[model samples]
Target: MSTKRYCYSCDLKNDSKLIAEYKAYHAAGNAWPEITKSIKDAGIVDMQIYLTGNRMFMIMEVDETFDPVKKAELDAINPKVQEWENLMWNYQQELPWAKDGEKWIPLEKVFQL
Candidate 1:
């Protein structure tokens, strides 16, 4: 079975306090179990999020059958997932060029060796 990787990015509210709070929530032993389970249940094989200043880069490795659209639809109906996303939105913001409702915009592949 082959896996596919996707890269996405978003911005965090640029306040240092808020950024620190966000990082604290993501620190070892601090991650929410429900949120992590939801991710895996959506057919994600693995996921990592990196932060520099207020910018966030997320890399998701998903199973061959993963459907982001379907996953989103499911999330919409899951109260726990919706709560998690709403809590996260407190520290996140759309990229400058993103459409109104967009977050974690997919990045273009510009280089490969």
Candidate 2:
């Protein structure tokens, strides 16, 4: 099946120790099972996050069943998802232009060749 791709970015606290801990949490099989299950249940087939300095970029590929609105709704009702977000808040910061409560700000695509 074909998938759609989305990109987003967020910033990390400028503390090296926090960055290291964040990286460790995202290491292979280290993410909370609840969080992983929630992502798969949301129709996200694949996702990757990359870090440079204190900035993070994420790429996500989702199946046709995926809907961002529905995903957000689902997350809003899931305690585990809320827990993960709250915990991650310790290491993450909203983009300068992000609205209140926004963490990962979607990136507009440009110059694709």
Candidate 3:
């Protein structure tokens, strides 16, 4: 299995609202279930989410054959997923380096074990 880490930052001031939005979006929209289903359908082996301070992280172990671009396209096409993203955007602010509609920017790995 191969693993990847996704990192994103939230505004300190908007953290509470962002967290609330995340919870509400997942709970009301059944987003977590859908996400899990999609991941499993796409042959992901394992996944985990974590947060620290204003930083959010997701670790995923996906099948070697998984196509990221296709998965991204599928995400965009899911109405409930899109709705969840829209809801979360209300409390989300772009990072200093992000373009419009981008809530989280990827952090470059400068060092790794």
Candidate 4:
């Protein structure tokens, strides 16, 4: 089956201590089950995040059912997700081009092989 791929970028507070903590939080088996469940429920077939210094890049592959707007709406009502986001904000910073309160900014693909 085909999948839709999306990329996003965000930054963490430019501090080594906070960045280490953020990485540890996302380590294997470290994330809350409910948060993973919510992600799967949103039609995200796979997701991976990479980091360099304070910047983060996420690669997400989703099924045909995925809708970003719908995902946001679902996340809004889920207290667990909200909790996770609020906690993450302690380490994350909005990219300068991001809209206010936006964490992940969508990355535009400019070149492909």
lDDT of 4 by residue, 1-113 (tens): 77999999999999999999999999999999999999999999999999998999999999999999999999999999999999999999999988899999999999999
Would you estimate the TM-scores of all the predictions? 0.95, 0.98, 0.67, 0.98
- Model 2 residue 71 lDDT? 94
lDDT of 1 by residue, 17-106 (tens): 999999998888688898888889888999889999899999999997789999989989999888878898999999999999888899
Please say which candidate is ahead in lDDT: 1 or 4. 4
The TM-score, computed over Cα atoms with residue i paired to residue i, of candidate 1 is 0.95
The C-alpha local distance difference test score for the whole of candidate 4 amounts to: 0.96
Q: How well is each residue in 13-108 modelled by candidate 2, as lDDT tens digits?
A: 999999999999999999999999989988999999999999999999999999999999999999989999999999999888999989999999
19: Cα error in model 1, Å: 0.6
**Superior candidate under TM-score, 1 versus 3:** 1
Give me the overall lDDT of model 3.
0.63
Native-structure RMSD, model 4 = 0.6
Instruction: Summarize candidate 3's per-residue lDDT along 79-111 as a digit string, tens digits.
Output: 866776676666556666768767656556678
lDDT of each: 0.92, 0.96, 0.63, 0.96
TM-score of 4: 0.98
Q: What are the per-model numbers of colliding residue pairs?
A: 0, 0, 0, 0
